[model samples]
Target: MKTATGCTVISNGTAVIGTGAAPIKDATIVIRDGKIAYAGPVAQAPEVEPDATVIDARGGTILPGLIEAHFHPTYFNVEALEDLDIKYPVEYVTLLAASNAKLALECGYTSARSGGSLFNIDVWLKKALECDLVPGPRLAASGREICGVGGLMDWNPDYRKIGMDGLVLLVNGPDEARAAVRKLVKDGVEWVKTYPTGDAASPDVNDHHTLCMTFEEMHAVVATAHNHGLKVTGHCRATEGIKNALRAGYDTLEHGTFVDDEALEMILERNTPVVPALYFELASIERGPEFGLSQRVIDGHQETLEGGAESARRILRAGGRLGMGGDYGFGWNPHGQYARELSFFVNYVGLTPLEVLTCATKTGAEILGREHELGTLEAGKLADVLIVDGDVIGNISLLEDRKRFIAVMQGGIIKAGELFRSQA
Candidate 1:
């Protein structure tokens, strides 16, 4: 239900404002015209009109809606990589993408940025969400990823005559790189995804340490993306690849696993956001055998798990931005289990719950360039709020329980949660 123009108040909650501020006890949130008119202690809450719709939070935790910094809407039940592009036709994949978007919103994510998608599905998905044809998160869409021939994403054999074109645009040189960025711009993408390094999943040919795209190609991609008013992020893991991306003025790094001191210095200097995406490694290590992955692949995932966690810790200690989101939509780590990434960071990565929450909310928004309006529960910001039935600060895993989500408000409307049915 749309919030009335007069007011809608959320009362009797403990506010865990996403600005890293301490939780405010007995907090109240006032919504007016789809914006936060006030959010503070209940005693200080402004007077509301008599007809205002007041939803009682019942002493729950109220925080900003979570943001998924690296989302892949087209990757569902992906046991093998071919499931990403080849197994399902584009028509079925589009429907799957729409389902994943709604799943993300129901899981408490109100905003997301596409890490990559098949057939530029996320571009049209964003429009569908805007028109309310779909119930989903606000999205910053990146079409197909840009990959060098024989890179991590280029798994299909050329002789098969079935290319990787559905998921990635394979480019050979700097000119092709620029042309690929132009294609993404024409497709109406807000961000450009690139593969600068290979993955541990492809250990034999292009392992984690190998660079996929040349420095010149990387630079051309960044330059062209920036020129066309789009930001570029890369699946960077190797030290050299990370350095190349940073030197090329890339906007963000995904799975920045092997950051040496030199790369750390560069990252801190540039103030770039690094999404460790460590949860995917953990899932791979634990469940690879079930999916017919070889022992070598499992070992590679174990190594990546350790290295990515350590890099994330170092980045956090050095005051760098460490956002949260991982490669979900696989068989083990499915789309609705998005909050597991936050739990993994707190339990395994040695970060406090509050720290992980900040990464998922505040830093995640900063990475999307929407921090000013959507990251925090402050006055004058968009009324994107999540009211949990428990103290999420004390038990961060409470966010994983959708039943505990009393209300999930996006733009002051009750989009999902236990209270949504009554409100609608």
Candidate 2:
């Protein structure tokens, strides 16, 4: 794949299926012009480009590159949200975001959807990755999240003259919400992320259960973004927030920890995808001390964790799509450990290993609206592939190591690992 030519082929592997009907044994995948030409048994392999580069998986598992449905590339390696909002300079955060992107790619994630970012960093980074100016995943960029004043993202001290300007778009009403979303579209965002509720980490009246936006403001955001050809997702953990987002035509939900019967019904009826982001809550409880969180805050996180798990199960049982990813760049959950979400699904959410893989790949792509080109290994799909050296089905934890990958290829280009020889 380093030969400058985009033609490549990968052979001699067992393909783990992702929305491709079923798995294949002794498979051969061919990539021509950065797109899949064949993906099936080696016996029926087709001819490839005369000088095409070929990679031997050595009887490994060939799977679709994992997708991160909610990623914060601009947060960097911050110890807390305050670091991201106050201490870290915009220039440093932007540079650190580039490193995180490369790290995520090295971890075998070929695609990422930006949940939100500081200013328009995600916008510029997405363009850079697309144009080959940087090495990263195919990013669906969402710029600074729109939040109501004093909401979850409005973390600045009101009495202080200085404010956290780079982190959020502080909108006060319906008109401001509409303008915020329109400005995001104009700034080159593909998705609009909003704060429809507060955080459980907060202790005041603005707790996780507090509604951040009125119905009118939420409705205006959805309408404006949809009109400008963008999908709207929200940070909605409150039950009322979920209901409000649903009624306002929000396309997706993030961290739906407090969803109830009605919200579950609404989600299924609309077929809205949700990335439960279960790990962050657990991380807070387990590693909260290291981050200076109080005992009360840690206790609150335990409740949030239980509620998120139950909500996730209910959504899955109802046959609603559930994608993986959440707050991975924070101090507790660093980058390159994205595969942990898969384990959380199996051990906590009660999903099987196969089910977790399918959700992370196929359903994640569906959430990002790239179901055709990504999420599966088949003819005509982009060559976004991960060659794993171990039996992924038996021990999903092996994915936590970047070295476990024999090669990570996206669009016929090798991003990590090495594939030296081929027989085509």
Best by lDDT: 1
Which tens-of-lDDT digit does each residue in 1-424 have in candidate 1? 2343668999998998888888999999999999999999989888999989998988889999999999999998788896676788888999999999988998999999999999989999999998889999999999899999889988888875655458899989999999999989999999999999998889998999989999999999999999889999999999899999999999999989999999999999999999998999998888888888889988988888999999999999999999999899889778898899998998999999888989999999999999888889988888989999998888889988999999888989889999986766
The total number of steric clashes, by the backbone 3 Å criterion, in model 1 comes to 0
Candidate 1 pairs with clashing backbones: none
Instruction: Note the Cα lDDT for every prediction shown.
Output: 0.91, 0.85
**Which runs in model 1 stand beyond 4 Å of their true positions?**
1-4, 160-164
Encode model 2's per-residue lDDT on 1-424: one tens digit a residue.
1213456778888887687356688988888777888888889998776887777888778999999999999987577676777776788888988999998898889999999998689999998898888888889999888889888777778664334357688888999999888888789899999989987788675677888888899999999998999999999889999999999998899988898999999999999998988888888888889988888778778888899999998898889988989788878878877888888788877887788888889988998899999999878888899999877877788778777789888887777865422211
Error (Å) of candidate 2 at residue 412 is: 0.9
Report how far residue 352 has shifted in candidate 1, in Å. Answer: 1.3
lDDT of 2: 0.85
